[model samples]
Target: MHGPLKGLFAWRFVVRAEDDVRHPDGRASTSLRQGVRHQDPEPIVANFILDTASPHTKVCPETLIALRYNGDMRPGQSATVIVQGVRTPCVVGRPGEANSIGAPFIVDGSLTFYFDHRLDAPVLYVDDENADLRCRAYR
Candidate 1:
């Protein structure tokens, strides 16, 4: 039951990073880097996917900043996240890249918002563990 979400209010999810990575193709990976070239976590501003059936949410480097999570509301300034008490650095780029701002996706199962028109909506990442937070703006 998915269609154009026009004129409908947008929603957000603020969740903690899980140890699982659900790829766009419905494949689950253990690490986000997928063992390509593991690096430390860094500050980022990226968009995430809002899946109602999904048990988790994800973010890239760009959406993390644009959404103003982890104290990165200003431009030219880096953002960061703390995992296990260790602070790591991160940045946002494009999808499938090491540092993407947002990852495009189609979420079905439990998303509950109204749209007057169809939209490829952007879901910002919040500095939370659970992807259940909400935002008030549309970017």
Candidate 2:
């Protein structure tokens, strides 16, 4: 008795920092957290973990520090995040060292993750394309 296995496991997302972005014009963007925001220090690729329960996108504090992210966010702040070559101005902060790509980013980017569907791998799909594994723009 053999059949296709089925289960919903946490899917991981890997993305690279396209560049350091800051609040444009310093006009107090309501889209961002209600506080002072700053520009990114540097840009570098980072890995992420998908979590639907999370309300905002979270990056490792170490990476934020390395990138010179100087924003005021107890939860997070709006920043430009590049995923699978897709860019979106979303909230990101140094919640920890591990990148936590939460529902906010996924919903904003319209991404999908598949599992237990007779698939050959564990990965998130952007616009229904497996471009995550072969994105050159990020490189």
Candidate 3:
């Protein structure tokens, strides 16, 4: 069987050293935010800082609360995540004391940081638009 493929692109911004500070206990930390959306009748969307080091995606408590109003979401539940037109299955978890994304969806995406004397920016590409791919941005 064959299906339509989709792709999405986004720009990345760097958090300044002053903005990226260490916790009092001595933990390296940085501020990185990205746009995330879910494919639903009333889509759940928010801007979340990307954490490549994190094995599981984390969502903000408030965001989750809002999502609950729209869809049935439990503390330990699974939801479909749409990022840059890519779909990925992710577990739902509250950020608790930490600021996090509402939908902790994970997908196979690429992030490239360009470093040049004149220009410095990072770009994120989610999902490949190859003809052979089976994933679709929309149902």
Candidate 4:
């Protein structure tokens, strides 16, 4: 399939530390506010952290339950994920409580991290094909 670069594929979100929150009473909250999103028709739309070190992409059990996805567990299952208009075939698996997109999605795709020297914030870039190689190499 074609890559995200050919389509509109990009997501942006805010990040805050656990200790960096203000309560209604103007008190500092110690709990972390994890990034999350929900959309209709699709059933579930939770925020996921991209982990380049991880070997496989995984979704939280809660997300699967929320989606009401009743597929066979044997050998896992494949799902078509439409990101920025690009339909991608992804292998779904159960991992921890948090949803994470790992190297499995990146090895064949292109990734770029934008960082500013003055800020700790970063922006992630994804493309269907490896920009460096111009195409995905399979062994």
On TM-score, the leading prediction is 2
So what's the TM-score on candidate 1? Answer: 0.22
Q: Write the per-residue lDDT of candidate 2 for residues 1-139, one digit (tens) a residue.
A: 1132233234434444434343567553322222323432234666565667978666655555544444543446555556555554446555654566778667655577665446655666576455454444434
Candidate with the larger lDDT of 1 and 3: 3
List the RMSD of every prediction in angstroms. Answer: 13.8, 8.6, 16.6, 17.3
TM-scores, all candidates, are 0.22, 0.50, 0.42, 0.44
Q: Evaluated with lDDT, which candidate comes out highest? A: 2
- Over the stretch 1-139, how does candidate 1's per-residue lDDT look in tens digits? 1355333323432322223344579996543333322443333323233333433223353455333343322433433333222222333334442222122122211122433335655433334433232221110
- Model 4 over residues 65-110: C-alpha lDDT tens digits? 4544443322346543333222234456665444556665554456
> For each candidate, what is the lDDT?
0.33, 0.52, 0.38, 0.43
User: Which pairs clash inside model 4?
Assistant: 3-128, 4-128
In candidate 2, which residue ranges exceed 4 Å CA deviation? 1-43, 70-80, 88-97, 116-121, 128-139
Which 10 successive residues of model 2 have the least lDDT summed? 1-10
- Ranking by lDDT, best first? 2, 4, 3, 1
Off by over 4 Å in 4: 1-43, 72-96, 117-119, 127-139
lDDT of 3: 0.38
Query: In terms of TM-score, which candidate is stronger, 2 or 4?
Result: 2
C-alpha positional error of residue 131 in candidate 3 after TM-score superposition, expressed in Å: 8.2
Root-mean-square deviation of Cα positions for candidate 1 versus the true structure, in angstroms? 13.8
